[model samples]
Target chain A: MDTIDNLADNQPKLVGHDHVAQINPLLPLRKWLYSWLFDPGIPGNHQKAVDRWISILIVANLFALLFEHVDVIYEANKHWFHWFDIFSVAIFTVEYLVRLYLAPEDREFGGKKFPRLRYISSPFAVIDFLAVAPFFLQAVIAVDLRFLRSLRLLRILKLFRVLIPACRQFVKVNAGRTFRQKVHALVFAGEYGGTLHNIFDMFIALWVVVSVVAVVLESVQTVHYVLNLQFVILDAVAVAVFTVEYCMRIYSCVEEPGFQRAVLGRFKQARTPSVVIDFLAILPFFLEVFLHHLFDLRFLRVFRLARLLKLTRYTSATSTLTRVIVREWPVISAAAFVMLLLVVLTASLGYLFEHEAQPDKFENIPQSIYWAVVTLASVGYGDISPITPAGRAMTIILALLGIGIFAIPAALFSAAFSDELTKEREKLKRDLYEMLADGVISPDEAAIINREARRLHLRQNEVDHMIEKARNDRESVADLSGLPIHRIAAKPEHAIEHYKALLGQIRQLGILTDGLQFEQLARQADRLTSSELALWRQIHGNHQSQP
Target chain B: MTDTPEQSGVPLALAPALTLADMSFLVFLAAILMAVVWLGRIAYLEGVKTEVTKASGEAWVQWFTEASPKRFTPGFEPSSCAGGASPAGTNGKSAGSDAGASVNPVPERLWEGCLESLMKDVEPIAGLRNPFSGKPLMFAAKCDTDDRSLVGAMVLEKLTPTPPGSAVAYTTSSLVGADIIERKLQLRVTVCDKGAYPIRIAEVEF
Candidate 1:
């Protein structure tokens, strides 16, 4: 046991020496090279490399496709292209081998001699295989039309995974900054303040816009011939890709051991507002692909453009806006429901009042409701108008309600924004108090606080003053009180009403406490007895009298 | 309502003025090319930089070890002795040589440099002889290998272009029958182990 302990004690030193010896020769040069190839915090280098390789492969595949058509190039360079395909296959094969070699041993299936198959079955590995598979398939399969290389375009999707990690990190860092802006917008729209929910609404809006445009564009008879089978194919492909992505995300989360503990936990972590946006954006595509065959729903294909909402995932501001919409959705929905009910009631009244006078325009309640919708939406098409005096009066009243309904989203958004800010402030207060209890603050911690404050747009001086006051208060009561009075005041109920306001302040100061001792505060609280409480009350009464 | 020759039949020759459909197809093709070019440029810049840096770093490591020997004693600093034959070597090569031997004496780097030099020497002839990019040329030849009598036999030639600046060139030749055309100025032929009596040519004209 002593020998083992002694060996363990010397192990790290020996390893360090070994590393120094091995790395010393290459250190200066390797450092320079590493610095050139990889930026310290930039997480996309590997992905970038993979993306480049994929691009090369795609281009090669495309050239192969083009070569088939241009006989001059094809006849002259047939042998060359064939050789190029072989080289690509060889490179891919080697890559597959290396990946199998590098992959975790446990993941190697059935302890088989041929581990490449196992590797290819993995998600990323499958993508890698797909990158090169189309060409190989074309080489072997005797198909009438050699259009399989078009499938090679799917390799572009792999780039998404490569960019995802970096993009996600970027979003995480900037999400807080944009959260307030989005919340304000949502409140102004009379929607919820959750960034994710707001994003969902934006996605819906995008879908509506895209569908309308598609329908409008399709309506033009001159261009209808141009829109052929390819449009349907594109829609189908888009739906499949999104559905696959959604399924994988959900499956990955559910398969995680921790996620199995709670169903909502999986949804909370996996069903991000962006993910919801992704689902909804692609939903129209799926609807068209599946339903178009069953019925004459070809016109609905225009809705597939709704997928543009997926762009929200790429921008922090948009994502935060989406969250705000989600947070305030229930309230906004309630308000909308009320507005809808009013529109229906008023439409019926208008139909009764105006149908006799303007038979062509207000033929039925449905037609009247359509006009009411356009008016309420602030989009008076001018095609339909009420001529009767009573009808005109009702129209004026309905227009006023439409304007009110338009303002509801904005009102809801403001309320939700305030709530978000409050939660953020409370969270900051808790974090600050906890840090103070740790009895130490590092520069990095300070920098973090400062950044946070700047992000929150708080007054730096005020935050500094607050942090100083807390620190001083903590120091003064360090010995006798065992816990600071300010720490007690920093509790959620006692802290500032606006969580964001406090967080902003804390961030500006960059105040961080390392190894905070919140357990000590709990212990101190445990020490408080009923007698002490009574004594505190008596002291408070005495103080009040003096004041 | 009748299917006219103009509507149903293939054009014997491409027209000078492109139709809208043809133009659209060309535009799509150009877009694909542009995307590929953009991606390729980024990848090439990054990949080449990374590879060059790695190579230079290894070279530096080799230079350092040659300059300072006593400072990096075996077992004292195993990592510094990497690329050497000793157990301390971690330069990715198997360690089983004398410690005093020259470090990083492997032939892989030499072979790669030779290949690159060969490629650069013959690059100009590439466009004239083989118009297609390097990848497809390699792919097609391998696919049609079985059609030839000699299944595994192939020839690779390193063709040096006239007045080469810094481009790689190669001509690959394969023989199947008397009618088959074998030699071209563009492709570099490295090996000819496939078939007997392959036809030879100087260059290909479009």
Candidate 2:
């Protein structure tokens, strides 16, 4: 026992030499490079920046590869494309070489014999190699031009560096969750969808725009003449994607609270306006394909423009506008009724005064109604005019009345839209406050905040400012007298809420108290169960040691 | 009733000018493409600079050590090295003892300069430029061994027009004993354009 104690006392201490590796000068840099190139699990803002940058480069490379297929774009911007390729190749090459150099530092590679060789053989390294190999390969050998392009596409595989980890994280997050839940996460904006969901939404939105543009351009004779086949192919692809999306939404909508009923719930979802729009967006292509011979279904192509409405589903302003319209429906309808009554009375008066003088022009009340409408709307076509003095005087009075009557609905909608948008923004602020109440934003809560901000058309910095404000508000409220936990806990219905509040207060206390005093207070507390006390101590210790 | 319908009263001038819309769409699409490419180029260059600056000396040393022959060290002089290791020499026999001993590694930093010097030796049969911008070109070369023979591959790039001292191109050329003696220094030049994707433009003997 004495020997053991003596040995312990004599042992070399790491206090002063904890970072002895720092003496090598290049150790930190080597470790940092190793972290970025090989081990994404290592935490650093620089690695994330590098990953984001590489992902962007991969996307840009894919874009460049795609644009190269378009002869006109490639021809006009040949040098830009060339310079970009050189730049991409340079970066990718550096990345590949750096990764190769740093492979021996990786946990998986470092423990093995011939670590660099093993790294070279790894699947990711192979992808990295293939990404740069073609650029060099084409330079040396006479590669088939078609084959070379296909080879260039291998650069997309480099995205696995970002994608694989994201996928793993997604899977780990959703493990033991139901398939319906997974599908729901993918289709809807919430905790489950993550970055993949964002990508999926972006893809769908892109297709919507593409299909709509194709429809518009197809109407142009010259463009239709040249790109008729392309338009057809694009429309078909867009329809397929929408069809799959529609099916997925219907299938997984049961995961939603209101739509929990299995079959009937799906029916309810299918009846939703956005879902109907989604159905209509893809229906034209199918109708044309199946029913083309039955009738001149060429007119149905106009409905392809309905795809643009799909974008409204991704944004909140449309839903807010719908709410405003619904809320102000009565006033708008009354204004419409007044406008209708005035139009009919104006038509009658115009016909009575001008019928004898301009029988051919005023001909009948219905014809005069057209003139009345044209004048009322302030869109005078000059196609008709009342000749008599009484008729001219009536026309002037009616046009003046028309302007005021027509402005009522416009004014109402403008006011209501503004009011509704403000309310929605306020609601978002409330949600942000609730999120910051706990003093930390979970990934799921952050995603919800992000979605809400985007729906409100709030810029990223604006969302960040709101979050900061919410945090500040919470901090202010965290002052000694701001919230009473015992009073909050008095209501049995709010047991969980009170429990969370109590925990938060404890955490705050843990932050404020000295380590030894806090530990003593925690040990002396009898209210906490053993497990609860252990958890609190752990939390307290971690919080105190964070700096 | 007649089978043919009567034409409308609207004149051709009043009809929608599809040509104008199509032209505008094309212009819009082109502008977007150019913008994306321009932004991508700027971002990629910046990213590379940041990453490279962060991992500078040791990273390069490790990379070059793994990639190329030891002779291509930091202070290598291609003029002295290549001259000593003559193309006529087979493992330094034809080039005698003194010339063989003089053959040393080419400088890693001056690899591009080495290529430039080698290019000057080659008769100027053709000039390379960016076909679109008509700008002067620089090349990125890599040295490797294929079937026990020394080979160099060069990717020709148009130097970026803005921000001077950006887009520095480098090359590494391997010089094997028997291969250098037996074969011409094959410099397979590929122009960075889709149309020139299949190019093997130069094969110079030194």
Residue-level lDDT tens digits of model 2 in A186-270: 8987666766787678779978987888889878754553444456556656766787788778877988879989789999999
Per-residue CA lDDT of candidate 2, range B80-144, in tens? Answer: 23323333321223322355544743211223333454345422212433322333333333222
> B63 in model 2: Cα distance from truth in Å?
63
Q: Which residue segments of model 2 deviate by more than 4 Å?
A: A1-121, A347-374, A379-396, A428-451, A458-547, B1-206
As for model 2, its CA RMSD to the true structure in angstroms is: 29.7
TM-score of the second chain, each candidate in turn, equals 0.27, 0.25
Highest lDDT against the true fold, candidate: 2
Relative to the unseen true structure, what is the C-alpha lDDT of residue B11 in candidate 2, on a scale of 0 to 100?
26
Tens-digit lDDT string for candidate 1 (B26-94): 465466445444543443443333233223223323433343443234443223222223332223332
lDDT of 2 at A274: 95
> How does residue A235 of candidate 2 score in lDDT?
66
Q: Residue pairs in steric clash, candidate 2?
A: B71-B105, B76-B107
